[model samples]
Target: MCSHYEAVNKPERLKQAFQVAMPEGAKADVWPGYTGLFIRRPKEPPQEEGVAPWREAMVGSFGLIPHWAKDTTVCKRTYNARSETVATKPSYRDAWRLGRRCIIPAEAFYEPDWRSGRAVPTRIARSDGQPMGIAGIWTGWRAPDGTIIRSMSMLTVNADEHPLMRNFHRQEDEKRMVVILEETDYDSWLDERNAEPRTLLKQFDPARLTASV
Candidate 1:
């Protein structure tokens, strides 16, 4: 599960990268519950029928709390969605079917390696230094005060055989990594034409990534 990440880029840079205006205040490093940038298809009003659907970069809580969830507390339990079961999981199935897909850009992510008999934090990023756009799904949640808050969950795929990825995570746990996409694939990711996003879910090339304790 990708529990933490850094997205220090300001609104301008994020705008340049995605051609959309990003809500200000993204943090250098965001933990669970921290607000971060998420790119999603815009919600066009019924009156603007002819206008094209554009992408928007918005601030969203890191952990996703389904609309039907009892409270924000449930977000703590759904920060990551397993790719294999995302289609059917109660907490994620609605958004998955409704095409509430999003792209979560980050400088790097952290994980734990239990090779030494204790969990050791490891930093993983692209060797080239370019930020990665991880696949995710977003949902709209309503607060007790009748305010709507958007939240997201990163998607992960099995990577047990990945050399660099297999080294992380406990030996007893199933090896997994967030589905990182190529910059060229970002547009396709935001498009609704691709019904099965899983077809693009893949483990990034280990050769292009750097992992250190």
Candidate 2:
């Protein structure tokens, strides 16, 4: 469960990596309930045929705000949705069933390492220093005031067998890591045609990641 992460925070990087414009007032760091950027399928398809943009980047709360939520505080607990239950969980099932998948771009994410009998905050980033495209789900919740609140949640899977990811969190708990999609899978992930894109929720390759305390 990742609650803190370093966002891309650069216009050039966002354009080059995701080919989407940077969201207005995007933050450098994101935490639960904070605003962050997510890339999802455009609401309208391209009218032209040649090289149409397939992704649309938008700023939203780091935690997901379901339609039934009374207020925005629910985001704090909905930031990370387990992949196994996303399709059935009340908070995330709507987005999952509607194929509202997204990509959460980040430079790095933080986790706690408990190898020494004490929790030590650690940073995990790609070994190559490229931005990461984490798999997620997004939705728009209308508030009582008629304002639409957009939010998203990172999708995670069991990582007990992962060589690198298995090192984080408490040893007594099941190891888990966010689903980081491959560069080539970006468009496919945002495609709404695949109602249940469970195949794309594969664990990230640990060899490409480096962790430091």
Each prediction's whole-model lDDT (CA)? 0.83, 0.91
| Model 2 CA lDDT for position 135 | 97
Model 2's TM-score against the true structure: 0.95
> What 10-residue stretch in candidate 2 is worst by lDDT?
43-52
For candidate 2, the per-residue lDDT at 96 reads 91
Candidate 2, superposed: residue stretches over 4 Å from native = 45-52
List the candidate 1 regions with Cα displacement exceeding 4 Å: 44-53
Give lDDT tens digits, candidate 1, residues 57-112: 77888888899987887777788999899989999999898888899988889999
RMSD of each: 3.4, 2.2
